[model samples]
Target: PAVVNKIAAGEVIERPASVIKELLENSLDALSTRIDVDIEEGGTELIRIADDGEGIPADELPLAVTSHATSKLRQADDLFCVQTMGFRGEALASISEVSHFKIRSRTAEDHVGSELAVTCGERSDIRPIGCAPGTQIEIRQLFCNTPVRRKFLKRASTEFGYISEQFTRIALACPRMQLSLTHNGKSVHRLPATNELTERLTLFYGSQTVEQLIPIEAEHGGVRLWGYVGHPSLNKSTRKSQYLFLNGRYIQDRSLQHALNEAYRGLLMTGRHPVAFLFLEMPSDQIDVNVHPTKSEVRFRDQQFLFRLLLSTLRTKFLQSD
Candidate 1:
């Protein structure tokens, strides 16, 4: 039986932030070095993502916004050895299901690309159009199909703040991507591609935040951890600022998060959280990247070793600063 792709989109694309995350990952997967994001009224009105990478072909344009369609993977084994940031292929479809979507894309080989317009998972128009060799996606009236979801939304200001933080985290992780974001027609962030991670960190966080960073590096059993962490005195009022990435992908593993906090045991005041931005790199086979639908959570085969490694590396950083 052929399942309805429309119903599935409702589960995958729930909010504006979710749409933003998926589009950003697609840009990264396309090896795009530059990505521009523009949003209006916390994405309730408009959200647009433009990337200068290999765009979809005229024929693939329809499938690109169809459920369960992906250019990232083909087989079950590919899931285990994942390298690209996204594989579900549900983002575009999901976003299209709940909002007004228009995709203008062109491939290098074709003189003319195609434009696709979809409303709530229904195709209203698909036509050939001349455009640059890249992708531009515009979404409007997010979550319009699901009135219940809209009811639960926070204030526009609060939602925009969350979106800003998400983009900043992604920018910091992928310093090589020239990222720009705007809110309500005003520019809020513009990060040019740079080889130096420190500069990106400084730009993402202010100069004041960078002043508190301490560099840390550790290698054990072929795996290496490298990055910066905030000083004990610079503990944040909340844990939102704390971040960790594994091979340039942001992740949240309970084991890893606990190991980090345990390393800062006595250094942190009660209820305060220390900030971190560390990258853990190892053999791809050693980690299971398919644990989460969003690809933000990973499960390691040797969980104990990773936990210990994270704790020891962080502890050494704190000790050296003493």
Candidate 2:
């Protein structure tokens, strides 16, 4: 069973950045309002995520890392409408299999916290501990048991770059969450809670980019679209500036990319892409997220409808400005 976990861990635990992404999703799923991340040696040495959210019970600490065990889903039908960020339930188990993992949590009603450690799939008894009313998880020696994976890892600087990109996505997606990042004992980013998305936009893209952004929002056929689409003059040479999210979850879909391109085809010059931070909120039943292990890709039931809706939204906005 342990060997099976190690093999399966490879599917989701790709690298240090992968660990960061999964852990952040768990924190968000817990309804965390404030999250702090600390990384060392590009997260291969240590990755710590602390969140002020509802914590787990003392007894459930062990079940938290159990394979295929999750609180988000009760039946097979629950997979169709997963609203939480970490639903697969295999993430924590997968992460623990490849790394030295420990989770300490304390609920508001509990007088003391509970701490549990699972190192390389070896479970340790839950112990009583003292902590604040929240949860904190730490990962150390990631991929240490898998020498091949460790060898394939890039340099610390390059790995941290990937982690930074992941951080940027989560921070942007939840701008209202108080988020902070620290690398190698140095503070990299500290974003305060805010109601406006422009603050985060300016922080990430600069004042010039924010000033040129035009608000775009509307609802059609039960799908709500909101976010900023850059002016044609504010185009970029690459799609790196195009950030798309569905129901608050980041996704990479070719159909949506095509819709974006079709919307800006004549507006942008060849090889140029428009900057957009667009989000689509639709009924969870309308999409299927089980297509990927990491849930980064989704399949829409009526994809053409989404494609046309996106294209029309941008094209109409552009036409209005003209």
Candidate 3:
């Protein structure tokens, strides 16, 4: 069982950034208004996430680290309509299987919080303590028990870069949530809660980048698309700046990428890519989020219709701007 868990951990927790992504999703699922992330040595040495959200009860803390124990799913039917980010309940369990994990949480109704510590899937300690009305999780020596997985990690800088990008993506998706990130005791990003997407974009990209963005808003066949796309004059050599969100969740879709590229067919150079931050809103049943374990990729029910809608809407917007 231990070996099986370690193997599954490798699948979900591929790298330090993967751990960060899962934790951030959990925090968001908890309805956290503010999240603070701190990492050291690219999260290999330590990763701590604190959130101002509803905390776990003293008794549920243990089950939280148990495999397949999830609060997100009530029945088999709920699988098709998964609105929460961390549904499988594998993240905490998988993380605890390979790292020194500790969770301290207190609900508003509780006078004191409880802390549970687990090392390599073994319960080391559990105690009641005073804490704020939220959850704080601390992980140290990630993948210590799985040397093979640890060996595959890139350099600290490279790993940290992935972590930072993940942080920015989550922050962008939830613009109303305050987020803070620190690396090696140095502050990397400190974003305040804002209702405007452009304001959040300015914080993530910069004022100069925001100035070059064209606002896009269109609706077709019960789907609404709204976001900012870079002006024709503002092209990038790489597609790193392109970000697409579906129903407030970050996703990567080849068809959507092709639609975006087609919209900019004549404006951009052959090798250059247009920067965009596009958001798609459609009914939950129209798409499936369970296609990928990481939930980064989704499957749409009507691919051709979506492609046409996106291409036509974006093309019209670009033509109008021109």
Candidate 4:
């Protein structure tokens, strides 16, 4: 079992950024409104996340990290999920297999919190601890037991860059969630909770860039789309700036990507991609998000319809003069 767990960790956790994404997802699943993250040595040494959300009960702490013992979606449904669900099953288990993992959490009703620690798949008995009303998780020495995996890690600066990118994606997806990030001992980002998406855009991109963005809002055929699309002047050399969130879950779809490019076809020069922060809302039955465990890709039931809708929406918006 230990060997299998280590193998799974190798597949799921490719880097510190991957770990960051999983932990952040868990926090969001817990309904955390405020999340604080601290990283040391680019998350090779330590990564700590504290969130103010409903915490795990004392009795459930063990099951939370149990391998392949998911308490969510045990039975496959005929239709794609009607709601966006967090991937909580193998994440904690795989993460614990590769690093020193500890979790301390308390609910509003509990007098005290419970703490659990796992060192390379060796879990300790749960113990009571004093903590605030929420959850705090610490991961230390990532890939420590797997020296081969650790060997492939890039430099601290480069790895942190990846972590920052992941953080940026989540922050943009959930604008109202208070998020803060610290590296080593210095603060990198201290974003206050805001319903305003432009505030986040300005924080990540410059204020000067935000001013040139075009706002899009439209609904058709039971699908609603709204977000900020960068003007042609703000085109990027790469597609990294494009973010499309479906039901608040970050996703990647080739049709959607192609549609975006097509929308800016004549506006952008060759080799340049449009900068966009697009949100999509539609009935869950019309799409299949079971494509990847990472939840980054989904299959739409009507691919051509989406492609045409997205392309026409942006193209038509750009045609109108502000």
Best by lDDT: 3
Candidate 4 regions exceeding 4 Å error are 73-84
What tens-digit string does per-residue lDDT give for candidate 2 at 1-322? 7788888899888899999998888888888899999999899899999999899999898888988888885443344332466747888999999889999999999999999999999999999999998999999999989999998999998999999989988888889999999999999999999888899888788999899998898899999988998998889998778888887778888998898888888887788998999888887778875586475778888999989888998889999998
Q: Each model's TM-score?
A: 0.92, 0.95, 0.96, 0.94
CA lDDT, every model vs. true structure: 0.82, 0.87, 0.88, 0.86
Off by over 4 Å in 1: 1-6, 74-83
- How well does model 1 score by local distance difference test? 0.82
> Over the stretch 1-322, how does candidate 3's per-residue lDDT look in tens digits?
9999999888899999999998998888888899999999999999999998899999899999999999885443243332577758999999999999999999999999999999999996679999999999999999999998888999998999999989988988889999999999999999999999899898877899899999888888788988899998899999889999887778899999999888888898789998999888888778865576585787888988989888888788777887
Model 1 C-alpha lDDT per residue in residues 1-322, reported as the tens digit of each score:
1235546665666667778888888888877778999999988889999998888888888999877788785444344332576657778877888888999998778898889999877796679887878899999988777788877878777778878877876897888889999999999998889998889888767789888998888899888988888999988889877788777778788998899889999998899998888888887777765575664787888999989998988887788888
Work out how many backbone clashes candidate 2 has. Answer: 0
In model 4, what are the clashing residue pairs, if there are any? none
Give candidate 3's TM-score.
0.96
Measured by TM-score, the strongest candidate is 3
Q: Provide the lDDT at 256 for model 3.
A: 92
